[model samples]
Target: MIRLMQHADIHSVFNIEQQVQSHPWSLKQFAEAVDSYQCTVIEQQGQLVGFCILQPVLDEANLLLMAVAPDQQGNGLGYQLLEHSIEQLPNQPVQIFLEVRESNTAAIRLYEKAGFHQIDVRKNYYPNPDGTREHAVIMVKACSDDFAALFSSP
Candidate 1:
Protein backbone atom coordinates (compact mmCIF):
# COMPACT_ATOMS: atom_id res chain seq x y z
CA MET A 1 0.00 0.00 0.00
CA ILE A 2 1.24 3.48 -0.87
CA ARG A 3 0.12 6.38 1.32
CA LEU A 4 1.11 9.84 2.43
CA MET A 5 4.09 9.85 4.72
CA GLN A 6 3.56 10.65 8.38
CA HIS A 7 5.88 12.01 11.05
CA ALA A 8 6.23 8.58 12.61
CA ASP A 9 7.55 7.05 9.38
CA ILE A 10 10.59 9.28 9.13
CA HIS A 11 12.89 6.91 10.97
CA SER A 12 11.85 3.92 8.87
CA VAL A 13 12.19 5.95 5.67
CA PHE A 14 15.57 7.22 6.81
CA ASN A 15 16.69 3.65 7.40
CA ILE A 16 15.96 2.72 3.81
CA GLU A 17 17.65 5.90 2.65
CA GLN A 18 20.83 5.02 4.53
CA GLN A 19 20.89 1.53 3.12
CA VAL A 20 20.45 2.53 -0.50
CA GLN A 21 22.22 5.86 -0.82
CA SER A 22 25.90 6.59 -0.91
CA HIS A 23 25.25 9.92 0.73
CA PRO A 24 21.86 9.69 2.34
CA TRP A 25 19.63 12.55 3.36
CA SER A 26 19.77 13.44 7.02
CA LEU A 27 16.93 12.49 9.35
CA LYS A 28 16.04 16.18 9.59
CA GLN A 29 15.78 16.31 5.82
CA PHE A 30 13.25 13.49 5.84
CA ALA A 31 11.31 15.27 8.56
CA GLU A 32 11.22 18.47 6.55
CA ALA A 33 10.19 16.66 3.37
CA VAL A 34 7.29 14.97 5.14
CA ASP A 35 6.17 18.37 6.36
CA SER A 36 6.75 20.36 3.18
CA TYR A 37 6.54 18.08 0.16
CA GLN A 38 4.30 15.38 -1.23
CA CYS A 39 5.91 12.37 0.42
CA THR A 40 4.60 8.84 0.22
CA VAL A 41 5.57 5.57 1.82
CA ILE A 42 4.91 2.03 0.61
CA GLU A 43 4.19 -0.69 3.10
CA GLN A 44 4.26 -4.49 2.90
CA GLN A 45 2.85 -6.66 5.65
CA GLY A 46 2.33 -3.46 7.64
CA GLN A 47 6.03 -2.55 7.52
CA LEU A 48 7.44 0.40 5.66
CA VAL A 49 9.45 -0.75 2.65
CA GLY A 50 9.95 2.27 0.44
CA PHE A 51 9.23 5.97 0.08
CA CYS A 52 9.22 8.80 -2.45
CA ILE A 53 9.29 12.58 -2.22
CA LEU A 54 7.94 14.98 -4.81
CA GLN A 55 7.78 18.75 -5.06
CA PRO A 56 5.23 20.34 -7.31
CA VAL A 57 5.42 23.89 -8.55
CA LEU A 58 2.79 25.22 -10.88
CA ASP A 59 2.78 22.96 -13.94
CA GLU A 60 5.87 21.00 -13.10
CA ALA A 61 6.90 18.45 -10.50
CA ASN A 62 10.25 17.24 -9.27
CA LEU A 63 10.95 13.79 -7.93
CA LEU A 64 13.26 14.87 -5.17
CA LEU A 65 14.07 11.57 -3.52
CA MET A 66 13.05 7.92 -3.64
CA ALA A 67 14.36 4.74 -2.08
CA VAL A 68 13.54 1.15 -1.29
CA ALA A 69 15.09 -1.04 1.33
CA PRO A 70 18.07 -2.99 0.00
CA ASP A 71 16.29 -6.22 0.83
CA GLN A 72 13.30 -5.04 -1.14
CA GLN A 73 15.23 -4.17 -4.27
CA GLY A 74 14.21 -5.85 -7.57
CA ASN A 75 10.56 -5.72 -6.57
CA GLY A 76 8.07 -3.33 -8.25
CA LEU A 77 7.68 -1.12 -5.20
CA GLY A 78 9.77 1.73 -6.61
CA TYR A 79 7.77 1.82 -9.79
CA GLN A 80 4.51 1.80 -7.87
CA LEU A 81 5.66 4.65 -5.67
CA LEU A 82 6.76 6.67 -8.69
CA GLU A 83 3.52 6.14 -10.56
CA HIS A 84 1.41 6.95 -7.51
CA SER A 85 3.43 10.06 -6.81
CA ILE A 86 2.65 11.41 -10.28
CA GLU A 87 -0.99 10.48 -10.01
CA GLN A 88 -1.30 12.26 -6.69
CA LEU A 89 0.13 15.55 -7.91
CA PRO A 90 -2.08 18.43 -6.85
CA ASN A 91 -2.79 19.36 -10.46
CA GLN A 92 -1.46 16.90 -13.01
CA PRO A 93 1.84 18.54 -13.85
CA VAL A 94 2.70 19.28 -17.46
CA GLN A 95 6.17 17.92 -16.90
CA ILE A 96 8.04 15.89 -14.30
CA PHE A 97 11.74 16.16 -13.54
CA LEU A 98 14.25 14.14 -11.60
CA GLU A 99 17.98 13.62 -11.28
CA VAL A 100 19.71 10.31 -10.75
CA ARG A 101 23.30 9.39 -10.19
CA GLU A 102 24.89 8.44 -13.47
CA SER A 103 25.86 5.10 -12.03
CA ASN A 104 22.40 4.19 -10.83
CA THR A 105 21.25 2.26 -13.86
CA ALA A 106 18.39 0.56 -12.05
CA ALA A 107 16.78 3.87 -11.21
CA ILE A 108 17.47 5.24 -14.66
CA ARG A 109 15.79 2.24 -16.26
CA LEU A 110 12.81 2.61 -13.93
CA TYR A 111 12.43 6.30 -14.80
CA GLU A 112 12.78 5.59 -18.49
CA LYS A 113 10.18 2.84 -18.23
CA ALA A 114 7.88 5.48 -16.71
CA GLY A 115 8.43 7.67 -19.83
CA PHE A 116 11.17 10.01 -18.63
CA HIS A 117 14.01 10.80 -21.01
CA GLN A 118 17.34 12.40 -20.34
CA ILE A 119 17.47 16.15 -20.81
CA ASP A 120 20.86 17.10 -19.39
CA VAL A 121 23.61 16.17 -16.99
CA ARG A 122 25.07 18.02 -14.06
CA LYS A 123 28.76 17.49 -13.43
CA ASN A 124 29.84 16.71 -9.91
CA TYR A 125 26.26 16.86 -8.81
CA TYR A 126 26.51 14.22 -6.09
CA PRO A 127 29.15 13.61 -3.49
CA ASN A 128 30.73 10.18 -3.29
CA PRO A 129 31.98 8.29 -0.26
CA ASP A 130 35.44 8.13 -1.80
CA GLY A 131 35.98 11.91 -1.77
CA THR A 132 34.94 12.19 -5.37
CA ARG A 133 31.82 13.55 -7.02
CA GLU A 134 29.41 11.83 -9.36
CA HIS A 135 27.48 13.25 -12.27
CA ALA A 136 23.70 13.45 -12.18
CA VAL A 137 21.60 12.56 -15.20
CA ILE A 138 18.71 14.95 -15.46
CA MET A 139 15.53 13.50 -16.90
CA VAL A 140 12.08 14.79 -17.72
CA LYS A 141 8.71 13.45 -18.78
CA ALA A 142 6.26 15.62 -20.63
CA CYS A 143 2.72 14.97 -19.55
CA SER A 144 0.48 15.17 -22.57
CA ASP A 145 -3.22 14.35 -22.76
CA ASP A 146 -2.30 10.67 -22.97
CA PHE A 147 0.28 10.84 -20.22
CA ALA A 148 -1.62 8.55 -17.92
CA ALA A 149 -1.95 6.02 -20.70
CA LEU A 150 1.79 5.54 -20.71
CA PHE A 151 1.53 3.50 -17.55
CA SER A 152 -1.45 1.45 -18.68
CA SER A 153 0.69 -0.95 -20.69
CA PRO A 154 1.90 -4.16 -19.10
Candidate 2:
Protein backbone atom coordinates (compact mmCIF):
# COMPACT_ATOMS: atom_id res chain seq x y z
CA MET A 1 0.00 0.00 0.00
CA ILE A 2 1.10 3.56 -0.67
CA ARG A 3 0.26 6.48 1.56
CA LEU A 4 1.33 9.98 2.48
CA MET A 5 4.35 10.21 4.75
CA GLN A 6 3.90 10.86 8.43
CA HIS A 7 6.06 12.44 11.11
CA ALA A 8 7.28 9.10 12.40
CA ASP A 9 8.67 7.83 9.08
CA ILE A 10 11.29 10.54 8.79
CA HIS A 11 14.02 8.57 10.52
CA SER A 12 13.50 5.44 8.48
CA VAL A 13 13.23 7.46 5.28
CA PHE A 14 16.44 9.29 6.06
CA ASN A 15 18.25 6.02 6.74
CA ILE A 16 17.05 4.57 3.45
CA GLU A 17 18.10 7.69 1.59
CA GLN A 18 21.57 7.57 3.11
CA GLN A 19 22.08 3.90 2.47
CA VAL A 20 20.89 4.04 -1.11
CA GLN A 21 22.41 7.25 -2.40
CA SER A 22 25.90 8.78 -2.21
CA HIS A 23 24.28 12.14 -1.53
CA PRO A 24 21.02 11.89 0.34
CA TRP A 25 18.64 14.56 1.40
CA SER A 26 19.02 15.56 5.04
CA LEU A 27 16.42 15.33 7.73
CA LYS A 28 15.73 19.03 7.32
CA GLN A 29 15.08 18.53 3.62
CA PHE A 30 12.66 15.71 4.20
CA ALA A 31 11.07 17.71 6.99
CA GLU A 32 10.53 20.59 4.62
CA ALA A 33 8.92 18.29 2.05
CA VAL A 34 6.64 16.82 4.66
CA ASP A 35 5.75 20.28 5.87
CA SER A 36 5.47 22.01 2.53
CA TYR A 37 4.91 19.66 -0.37
CA GLN A 38 3.07 16.41 -1.01
CA CYS A 39 5.30 13.48 -0.12
CA THR A 40 4.20 9.86 -0.55
CA VAL A 41 5.59 6.53 0.56
CA ILE A 42 5.02 2.96 -0.56
CA GLU A 43 4.81 0.13 1.95
CA GLN A 44 4.52 -3.57 1.40
CA GLN A 45 3.49 -5.71 4.35
CA GLY A 46 4.23 -2.66 6.49
CA GLN A 47 7.81 -2.26 5.26
CA LEU A 48 8.90 0.90 3.49
CA VAL A 49 9.55 0.25 -0.18
CA GLY A 50 9.87 3.72 -1.72
CA PHE A 51 8.86 7.36 -1.54
CA CYS A 52 8.50 10.42 -3.80
CA ILE A 53 8.47 14.16 -3.06
CA LEU A 54 6.54 16.58 -5.26
CA GLN A 55 6.20 20.33 -5.29
CA PRO A 56 3.42 22.08 -7.19
CA VAL A 57 4.17 25.51 -8.59
CA LEU A 58 1.50 27.16 -10.71
CA ASP A 59 0.59 24.71 -13.50
CA GLU A 60 3.70 22.65 -13.06
CA ALA A 61 4.89 20.06 -10.57
CA ASN A 62 8.47 19.36 -9.62
CA LEU A 63 9.58 15.94 -8.54
CA LEU A 64 12.23 16.81 -6.01
CA LEU A 65 13.25 13.48 -4.53
CA MET A 66 12.50 9.83 -5.09
CA ALA A 67 14.16 6.79 -3.58
CA VAL A 68 13.58 3.09 -3.32
CA ALA A 69 15.13 0.72 -0.82
CA PRO A 70 18.23 -0.78 -2.42
CA ASP A 71 16.90 -4.26 -1.86
CA GLN A 72 13.62 -3.40 -3.55
CA GLN A 73 14.90 -2.27 -6.92
CA GLY A 74 13.51 -3.93 -10.11
CA ASN A 75 10.27 -4.67 -8.30
CA GLY A 76 8.24 -1.91 -10.03
CA LEU A 77 7.67 -0.18 -6.68
CA GLY A 78 9.27 2.97 -8.00
CA TYR A 79 6.80 3.11 -10.83
CA GLN A 80 3.92 2.70 -8.45
CA LEU A 81 5.14 5.48 -6.21
CA LEU A 82 5.76 7.76 -9.18
CA GLU A 83 2.39 7.03 -10.71
CA HIS A 84 0.79 7.75 -7.39
CA SER A 85 2.45 11.14 -7.27
CA ILE A 86 1.27 11.94 -10.78
CA GLU A 87 -2.22 10.90 -9.81
CA GLN A 88 -2.25 13.45 -7.03
CA LEU A 89 -1.69 16.42 -9.29
CA PRO A 90 -4.65 18.68 -9.77
CA ASN A 91 -6.87 18.22 -12.82
CA GLN A 92 -5.38 20.68 -15.24
CA PRO A 93 -2.96 20.95 -18.13
CA VAL A 94 0.14 20.80 -16.00
CA GLN A 95 3.76 20.04 -16.82
CA ILE A 96 5.90 17.74 -14.67
CA PHE A 97 9.66 18.10 -14.38
CA LEU A 98 12.43 16.22 -12.61
CA GLU A 99 16.17 15.72 -12.72
CA VAL A 100 17.96 12.40 -12.65
CA ARG A 101 21.67 11.70 -12.42
CA GLU A 102 22.96 11.29 -15.95
CA SER A 103 24.39 7.94 -15.01
CA ASN A 104 21.23 6.63 -13.42
CA THR A 105 19.89 4.58 -16.30
CA ALA A 106 17.34 2.77 -14.20
CA ALA A 107 15.77 6.03 -13.05
CA ILE A 108 15.83 7.49 -16.55
CA ARG A 109 14.13 4.40 -17.88
CA LEU A 110 11.46 4.53 -15.25
CA TYR A 111 10.77 8.20 -15.86
CA GLU A 112 10.58 7.68 -19.57
CA LYS A 113 8.16 4.80 -19.13
CA ALA A 114 6.01 7.11 -17.04
CA GLY A 115 5.65 9.63 -19.93
CA PHE A 116 8.43 12.11 -19.07
CA HIS A 117 10.79 13.24 -21.83
CA GLN A 118 14.28 14.58 -21.49
CA ILE A 119 14.05 18.30 -21.95
CA ASP A 120 17.62 19.37 -21.26
CA VAL A 121 20.71 18.65 -19.22
CA ARG A 122 22.10 20.52 -16.25
CA LYS A 123 25.89 20.62 -16.04
CA ASN A 124 27.46 19.54 -12.75
CA TYR A 125 24.09 19.43 -11.09
CA TYR A 126 24.65 16.65 -8.55
CA PRO A 127 27.39 15.97 -6.02
CA ASN A 128 29.58 12.91 -6.43
CA PRO A 129 31.20 10.88 -3.67
CA ASP A 130 34.66 11.76 -4.98
CA GLY A 131 34.09 15.43 -4.15
CA THR A 132 33.20 16.22 -7.75
CA ARG A 133 29.93 17.02 -9.47
CA GLU A 134 27.97 15.16 -12.11
CA HIS A 135 25.51 16.29 -14.73
CA ALA A 136 21.79 15.60 -14.53
CA VAL A 137 19.19 14.97 -17.21
CA ILE A 138 16.29 17.35 -16.98
CA MET A 139 13.06 15.63 -18.02
CA VAL A 140 9.58 16.94 -18.45
CA LYS A 141 6.18 15.73 -19.66
CA ALA A 142 3.13 17.55 -20.82
CA CYS A 143 0.02 16.15 -19.26
CA SER A 144 -3.43 15.87 -20.73
CA ASP A 145 -6.07 18.36 -19.82
CA ASP A 146 -7.28 15.90 -17.23
CA PHE A 147 -4.40 14.56 -15.17
CA ALA A 148 -6.41 11.50 -14.21
CA ALA A 149 -5.73 9.93 -17.59
CA LEU A 150 -2.15 9.42 -16.57
CA PHE A 151 -3.20 7.17 -13.72
CA SER A 152 -5.96 5.13 -15.27
CA SER A 153 -5.93 1.46 -14.33
CA PRO A 154 -2.91 -0.12 -15.96
Candidate 3:
Protein backbone atom coordinates (compact mmCIF):
# COMPACT_ATOMS: atom_id res chain seq x y z
CA MET A 1 0.00 0.00 0.00
CA ILE A 2 1.09 3.57 -0.67
CA ARG A 3 0.54 6.46 1.71
CA LEU A 4 1.76 9.91 2.65
CA MET A 5 5.17 9.79 4.22
CA GLN A 6 5.73 10.92 7.79
CA HIS A 7 8.76 12.18 9.66
CA ALA A 8 9.47 8.76 11.09
CA ASP A 9 9.93 7.19 7.68
CA ILE A 10 13.07 9.21 6.91
CA HIS A 11 15.43 6.73 8.49
CA SER A 12 14.14 3.83 6.44
CA VAL A 13 13.93 6.00 3.38
CA PHE A 14 17.55 7.02 3.81
CA ASN A 15 18.61 3.42 4.28
CA ILE A 16 16.83 2.45 1.09
CA GLU A 17 18.52 5.32 -0.69
CA GLN A 18 21.95 4.21 0.45
CA GLN A 19 21.32 0.69 -0.78
CA VAL A 20 19.95 1.82 -4.12
CA GLN A 21 22.18 4.70 -5.14
CA SER A 22 25.89 5.41 -5.09
CA HIS A 23 25.23 8.94 -3.82
CA PRO A 24 22.25 9.23 -1.51
CA TRP A 25 20.48 12.25 -0.20
CA SER A 26 21.41 13.42 3.28
CA LEU A 27 18.99 13.25 6.18
CA LYS A 28 18.57 17.00 6.00
CA GLN A 29 17.60 16.77 2.34
CA PHE A 30 14.94 14.16 3.08
CA ALA A 31 13.71 16.27 5.98
CA GLU A 32 13.33 19.27 3.71
CA ALA A 33 11.49 17.22 1.13
CA VAL A 34 9.06 15.96 3.72
CA ASP A 35 8.58 19.49 4.90
CA SER A 36 8.03 21.00 1.47
CA TYR A 37 7.28 18.54 -1.30
CA GLN A 38 4.46 16.14 -1.99
CA CYS A 39 6.25 13.12 -0.63
CA THR A 40 4.73 9.63 -0.63
CA VAL A 41 5.96 6.19 0.19
CA ILE A 42 4.85 2.73 -0.86
CA GLU A 43 4.75 0.15 1.87
CA GLN A 44 4.32 -3.60 1.93
CA GLN A 45 3.77 -5.36 5.24
CA GLY A 46 4.86 -2.11 6.90
CA GLN A 47 8.18 -1.98 5.03
CA LEU A 48 8.79 0.80 2.64
CA VAL A 49 9.05 -0.43 -0.97
CA GLY A 50 9.32 2.85 -2.80
CA PHE A 51 8.84 6.61 -2.62
CA CYS A 52 8.57 9.71 -4.78
CA ILE A 53 9.07 13.43 -4.16
CA LEU A 54 7.42 16.06 -6.29
CA GLN A 55 7.33 19.86 -6.43
CA PRO A 56 4.95 22.12 -8.27
CA VAL A 57 6.40 25.07 -10.18
CA LEU A 58 3.77 27.31 -11.66
CA ASP A 59 1.75 25.01 -13.96
CA GLU A 60 4.47 22.40 -14.06
CA ALA A 61 5.31 19.63 -11.62
CA ASN A 62 8.86 18.42 -11.14
CA LEU A 63 9.57 14.93 -9.92
CA LEU A 64 12.54 15.66 -7.68
CA LEU A 65 13.27 12.13 -6.62
CA MET A 66 12.04 8.55 -6.92
CA ALA A 67 13.45 5.32 -5.64
CA VAL A 68 12.40 1.72 -5.15
CA ALA A 69 14.04 -0.77 -2.86
CA PRO A 70 16.62 -2.72 -4.87
CA ASP A 71 14.83 -5.97 -4.10
CA GLN A 72 11.56 -4.54 -5.41
CA GLN A 73 12.80 -3.53 -8.82
CA GLY A 74 11.13 -4.97 -11.96
CA ASN A 75 7.96 -5.73 -9.98
CA GLY A 76 5.93 -2.76 -11.31
CA LEU A 77 6.11 -0.91 -7.99
CA GLY A 78 7.86 1.98 -9.66
CA TYR A 79 5.14 2.23 -12.27
CA GLN A 80 2.44 2.21 -9.67
CA LEU A 81 4.20 4.91 -7.69
CA LEU A 82 4.59 7.06 -10.76
CA GLU A 83 0.93 6.65 -11.64
CA HIS A 84 -0.18 7.47 -8.14
CA SER A 85 1.93 10.61 -7.98
CA ILE A 86 0.57 11.81 -11.30
CA GLU A 87 -2.96 11.22 -10.08
CA GLN A 88 -2.35 13.27 -6.96
CA LEU A 89 -1.35 16.43 -8.81
CA PRO A 90 -3.59 19.44 -8.27
CA ASN A 91 -6.12 20.04 -11.01
CA GLN A 92 -4.36 22.20 -13.57
CA PRO A 93 -2.91 22.05 -17.04
CA VAL A 94 0.34 20.84 -15.60
CA GLN A 95 3.37 19.38 -17.31
CA ILE A 96 5.20 16.77 -15.26
CA PHE A 97 8.96 16.54 -15.60
CA LEU A 98 11.77 14.39 -14.28
CA GLU A 99 15.42 13.72 -14.97
CA VAL A 100 16.98 10.29 -15.12
CA ARG A 101 20.65 9.48 -15.14
CA GLU A 102 21.59 8.70 -18.71
CA SER A 103 22.96 5.36 -17.64
CA ASN A 104 19.77 4.20 -15.96
CA THR A 105 18.15 2.49 -18.89
CA ALA A 106 15.55 0.62 -16.91
CA ALA A 107 14.19 3.79 -15.30
CA ILE A 108 14.21 5.58 -18.65
CA ARG A 109 12.24 2.73 -20.18
CA LEU A 110 9.71 2.80 -17.37
CA TYR A 111 9.26 6.54 -17.78
CA GLU A 112 8.67 6.07 -21.51
CA LYS A 113 6.11 3.36 -20.87
CA ALA A 114 4.23 5.76 -18.64
CA GLY A 115 3.78 8.28 -21.51
CA PHE A 116 6.72 10.59 -20.70
CA HIS A 117 8.82 11.66 -23.67
CA GLN A 118 12.43 12.70 -23.80
CA ILE A 119 12.30 16.46 -23.98
CA ASP A 120 15.93 17.46 -23.43
CA VAL A 121 19.20 16.51 -21.87
CA ARG A 122 21.06 18.15 -19.01
CA LYS A 123 24.74 17.93 -19.65
CA ASN A 124 26.78 16.67 -16.73
CA TYR A 125 23.81 16.82 -14.43
CA TYR A 126 24.81 13.98 -12.13
CA PRO A 127 27.96 13.32 -10.15
CA ASN A 128 30.43 10.48 -10.56
CA PRO A 129 32.75 9.12 -7.91
CA ASP A 130 35.88 9.73 -10.00
CA GLY A 131 35.33 13.49 -9.97
CA THR A 132 33.62 13.37 -13.36
CA ARG A 133 29.98 14.01 -14.17
CA GLU A 134 27.24 12.17 -16.03
CA HIS A 135 24.41 13.54 -18.13
CA ALA A 136 20.70 13.36 -17.39
CA VAL A 137 17.80 12.73 -19.72
CA ILE A 138 14.92 15.08 -19.13
CA MET A 139 11.51 13.52 -19.67
CA VAL A 140 8.09 15.11 -19.57
CA LYS A 141 4.40 14.27 -19.86
CA ALA A 142 1.59 16.78 -20.22
CA CYS A 143 -1.51 16.31 -18.12
CA SER A 144 -4.81 16.85 -19.83
CA ASP A 145 -7.54 19.05 -18.39
CA ASP A 146 -8.97 15.84 -17.02
CA PHE A 147 -6.41 13.18 -16.04
CA ALA A 148 -8.99 10.40 -16.20
CA ALA A 149 -7.15 9.13 -19.25
CA LEU A 150 -4.36 8.14 -16.91
CA PHE A 151 -6.57 5.67 -15.10
CA SER A 152 -9.52 5.05 -17.37
CA SER A 153 -10.07 1.91 -19.42
CA PRO A 154 -7.75 1.83 -22.37
**Winning model by lDDT:** 1
Kindly report which residue stretches of model 2 are placed more than 4 angstroms away from their true locations once superposed: 90-93, 147-154
* lDDT (10s digit) by residue, model 1, range 89-139: 878887999999999999999999999999999999999888999999999
Better of 1 and 3 by TM-score: 1
Candidate 2 per-residue lDDT over residues 98-140, each given as its tens digit: 9999999999999999999998999999998899999999999
For candidate 3, lDDT tens digit of each residue in 15-106?
Answer: 99988888899999999999888899999887898999988777678988889999888999999998888788664435789998999999
Candidate 1, residue 65: how far the Cα is off, in Å: 0.4
TM-score of each: 0.92, 0.90, 0.90
Off by over 4 Å in 3: 146-154
Model 2: lDDT equals: 0.88
Residue pairs of candidate 1 with colliding backbone atoms: none
State the number of backbone clashes in model 2.
0
What is candidate 3's TM-score against the reference?
0.90
TM-score of 1: 0.92
Q: Report RMSD for candidate 3.
A: 4.3
Using lDDT as the yardstick, the better of models 1 and 3 is: 1
- On a 0 to 100 scale, what is the lDDT of residue 135 in model 3? 99
Error of 2 at 25 (Å): 0.8
